[model samples]
Target: MTGWLDVHAHYLTDRYTQACTAAGHHHPDGMPALPAWNPQDALAFMDAAGIAASVLSVSSPGVHFGDDSLGADRAARDLARHVNDFGADLVTSHRSRFGLAASLPLPDIQGALRELDHAYGDLRADAIALKTNYHGRYLSDPAFSPVLTALDAHAAVVTLHPTSPPGWQRTALDRPRPMIEFLFDTTRCVIDLALSGTLARYPRVRWIVPHAGAVLPTLAHRVAFVCDLTGTPADLPTALGNLHYDLAGTPLPVALETLLKLAPPNRLLYGSDYPFTPAPAALQLATALRQSPHLQDATLDLTPDSPGATLFPRLFAQQGRPEDRASPA
Candidate 1:
């Protein structure tokens, strides 16, 4: 099997995690604990899982912790800068094995915009990572228009990852949000993007939806029907055709089968959601995906070239084949 290019991998720097912990995210989004991560460990996982390269992003709880006090914006801005800088350095160190999808400090619009410019301009990120919602401000909110506009201007690859819902306390049922709420949040934000005409407004920006489209495959018709009845701008089927989906989580015969209903084979990309997923579980997922009989029929192209290169040609080369050289000191 060819080495897989994973688009949905995650990274957690010590300072970034420390900030989250200080802000009371001891177990972010109600996970077991903040998983340990480092460049060498990440490369080891890639080698073991047959991943040629991965686009890394700082996952849930994002950069801002919703502190409305004085100097909150400055704090958020500093943390976001730190995260992007750290990610940029990671890319510099392992140009072949990893790419940074710089995280923004959203709900703090000015700060986010600053990071966006730095991310695309200086850091030269492979993509921009945004949570489905920021401090209850969904991507479709008018407040996010500036961010979207800037991203469109750059024709950036924007990855939509899920975070805790505003009502997570009531909705999560005391279980980890990643277990279920994450998928729902992904679906909710995507439907919002379509219905609110967000996708239409940002045609130049390409979006990568994680977790096998996160219930989108199954809800495509239902969403489109509602939009038609309500006279909303949502054309879910058409949008699905345009956007990309990553095989991050348990996208086996079920999710994969349904996802094909809306997207073509080439639009599908591999993702490992690692560290957050725990290496052992991630390995099982990667192994299972490769061995799926149905996937064999799809002729899935897991190579380094095709689709990803078209989006992130700057960082998609097979630079870390041996893995040892790519490992950080």
Candidate 2:
């Protein structure tokens, strides 16, 4: 229980500020833009929430947008390194209180590959945060193969963060729907990836879909029906079988229900989507985990690690052995 971890949090850095400033955007509370965040503040929040540490990354629309021009693409690379370097420093200085998900210049695939070399090879990121749609392209598109290939080669943890669909403009009156739309978008992108055989093609890459796995848990049967109806390959179950989901921004019952239908409790992980969603969600998630009858059967067959505790064996070392952690899902 002391090993509580928040898998979703965005810790802003100079590059994050520059990207936001460049886009003429401000922080949610209208707080003056920041060059970087204090990890100590994050530790304090973790203390308040009874969480021990958080896995950090840049939020949506990561530096790729800033790479608007050819010259900007180069700047994007530099900025990405800067942001990840800051992440490295944060974790190193804070000891075991934090982990990092490196940022990428996504749509710029070549740039992304280059950055991955450093982030994965050198920095050893716990995971990499990716948006379903970046700039104008869905991540399922073929052009992203190189990026996925690298991830597969490394067995990298790919944490999918939700971002609004391209051209989604919010009006003052309908503020919250954008978040809902983003969840749907995450679901859609995952479906697209599965339908396109991307998931089957890249078996080694570990995908951690956030937002309580978006809409997949509830809409899985419908998705299968339509895919089957349209003469689409019905390999979704295989794709979903190996995938993992972090319960961020999803209600406890909703998330648990989805887990029961679309996948197993073993693939489930706790994610708070912190700063955006607060500590209450984390407590709620824990409560749901303990109370959910759905997990009873799943938790029964403890291979080596408890089914639910295997993903981050490093963080949950007390619960299981490394071999159990490394066991195939």
Candidate 3:
């Protein structure tokens, strides 16, 4: 076995950052600055951290900037295409060490659908990376139903990443968005998915909740209570139970324990959150995951049989062949 398989690694390009900057997002998601990234640096970090392969996605503040004259929606779609192509080209170069989880510009139903086709069909991406919200709208919004429906049709592997929630400024208290808002926003989106019945509706869309289910394990019961109080009942537990979670951030005791209570151990996958997580911190998280007493099972090694690997078996096969990474339909 080479090492652990990481399903939540992130990558950035100078051009992407420049574009985001042009759109007035010099400090994306309230982070001080965007981390530098390239395949060589990522490979170095992965080798040091004992990661055999990493499924890469662009981090928060995804592809969209703000609405612009080029038409914010149109620009977003264009950028998503470019990002996916870049990722595909990267994977083509390093088929064994990396996998691409392509991006999509949502809330623009048609644009999203088009990009989804290109990402999965043309680029041959391994999975889909999505933000929790776009322009104050969340995955639970009815407007997203069409895109969600298409994902189910493909049985897509979807990773839900958190972004600054709409109006996060009021409650963020000037703290970094990743410090707290990221975790909370993920929970909020999961709750909305449950509340709006999106989770149940999109049964085939396998969801990979990041940061060890991020505040979701704690809120499972709270969501049911909220639904009960509002006289709008939803089977939140069943919905949450069906999803997969990546152990990205700090999943030592609290997050992992709570997550295990709601999700099965077999549904867990390893995540590094690199670049954004910094090499040292990411390595620390990786070591913690390896030594975690809670995950001493057979799947902990991140082999093909592991839950996360099951989502992208091609990447974890005994001799994974990236030659045909994503065969377009």
Whole-model lDDT values for every prediction: 0.84, 0.69, 0.84
Minimal lDDT window, size 10, model 1: 320-329
* Off by more than 4 A, model 2: 27-37, 170-178, 279-309, 313-329
- Which candidate would rank higher by lDDT, 1 or 2? 1
Q: Write the per-residue lDDT of candidate 3 for residues 1-329, one digit (tens) a residue.
A: 37777889998877898888887778987888888898889999999998878899988899977653358888888888888998888877777777899998776778889999998888889999999998889898887888999999999999889999989989799988999999999999988887777887888999999999999888898888888899988778778888888899889867898898888888888888999889999988777777788887527455656775678876766334534345322
Model 3 regions more than 4 Å off: 68-70, 318-329
Task: Write one digit per residue (lDDT tens) for candidate 1, span 118-224.
Answer: 99889889999999988777999998899999999999898889999988899899999999999999999998898788898999999999999998888889988
lDDT of 3: 0.84
Better of 2 and 3 by lDDT: 3
Candidate 3, residue 258: lDDT: 84
Give the TM-score (vs. native) of candidate 1: 0.93
Query: What's the CA error at residue 257 for candidate 2, in Å?
Result: 1.7
Q: List the residue pairs that clash in candidate 3.
A: 124-326
Residue 273 in candidate 2, Cα distance off native in Å: 1.1
